[model samples]
Target: MAKYVAPAISLSPFTCPACGAYAQQIWAHAIYVQPHANTNYDVAPLRRCKCASCQAYSFWSKETEAQIFPRAVASPMPHPDLPENCAAVYLEARNVVGDSSKAAAALLRLCVQHLLVHLGGKGKNLDDDIAKLVKEGLAVQVKDALDICRVVGNNAVHPGEINLDDDPAMAGQLFELINFIVRETIERQKRLAEMVDRLPQGARDAIAKRDAKALNGLA
Candidate 1:
């Protein structure tokens, strides 16, 4: 028998960012459980939910219930702290490197830039890494984006054998690596944003203003 258990409790209630209303229907009360019936067919936990605002009813099985469905958190609206200009800069640099696929390279660049900005006051000089990241605009860091100008990006462009067309798979692999970097970096920025929000308004304004010393918490 598959031993499965529902979460200890329903997730915390959150106001929907979209509709700006309490998402009461998200509190899942019914969880499907397998009966001690024939072991042949797997009995999964199930859930039924009704949206009070939308009047929509949905059914879910045990397997799907475990997945963080009806995500607990709502995405925040765009804030002023982010560097809006960097998006265009990322795109222009990617164009230099022939980033033609779905061409999300720029967004990946933005993701890394924000990650580094969040880490600005912290970590080693990392300025060389930052310079390279800003210049190259690629996710060279397997662990962190600072590894980019530190290694991959410039090295990949080294003048040895220009066989980019011969093996297009390399491009795909690079894109995939960048995609991972972008995904992780974006998540980090979200958490950091909340942290920044908790600080006093003066501190928040300093960081939002991109006051390097202020962001570093020096002042």
Candidate 2:
């Protein structure tokens, strides 16, 4: 059996798996001392933490067992060279529509979604960003030029009355969607190459000179 103890003091805090993003910046407290013989309690009182980027609360002990472990560290922002991982999710959503014609919009959705997923550069809220792209970006322009076919991507998964084959508006939306994605992808890719200057000096010179060898080993 375990013995009962009296109220105790808490001390300075470390990064909370729970909080970092508040405007004021507070830490979720970590307990350094505990009752000597208590076996029933798995964790201490809840403390608030904020997401450093979005300023969301970081709840303590959401993963109780996970609290005791280590996770591999990776860069906060994924390299610009690897935006394809971002594109993959959009492609996945495209497949959900089950039409080749949908590819263009699917690609666009992927771009918007990609930007959203990486909104913070830490690559957080990307899903939220995708949501905004659909709701704010695509849906906003529906009556004007964007059309609403792309809404099927969002609607099909939810309480929407639209279907892919039955709706031409959806088709038009898909067209606009594709154009958006392709333009953004090309721009970002170009921007990344410029930023990194990743190509060899000869490769850069070749591209500058319209050299066919810039096609990568194409003789």
What range of 10 consecutive residues in model 1 has the weakest lDDT sum? 1-10
Task: Please write out the lDDT profile of model 1 over residues 68-115, one tens digit for every residue.
Answer: 344322122222233455334443434433444223333434444444
In order, candidate lDDTs are: 0.43, 0.41
Candidate 2 residue 168 Cα shift, in angstroms, is 6.2
**Highest lDDT model number:** 1
Clashes of 2: 16
Score candidate 1 by lDDT. Answer: 0.43
How does residue 12 of candidate 1 score in lDDT? 28
TM-score of each model, paired residue for residue: 0.29, 0.29
lDDT of 2 at 131: 52
User: Model 2 off-target regions past 4 Å?
Assistant: 1-82, 90-112, 119-150, 168-179, 185-219
TM-score of 2: 0.29
Tell me how far the alpha carbon of residue 18 in candidate 2 is from the true structure, in angstroms, after superposition: 47
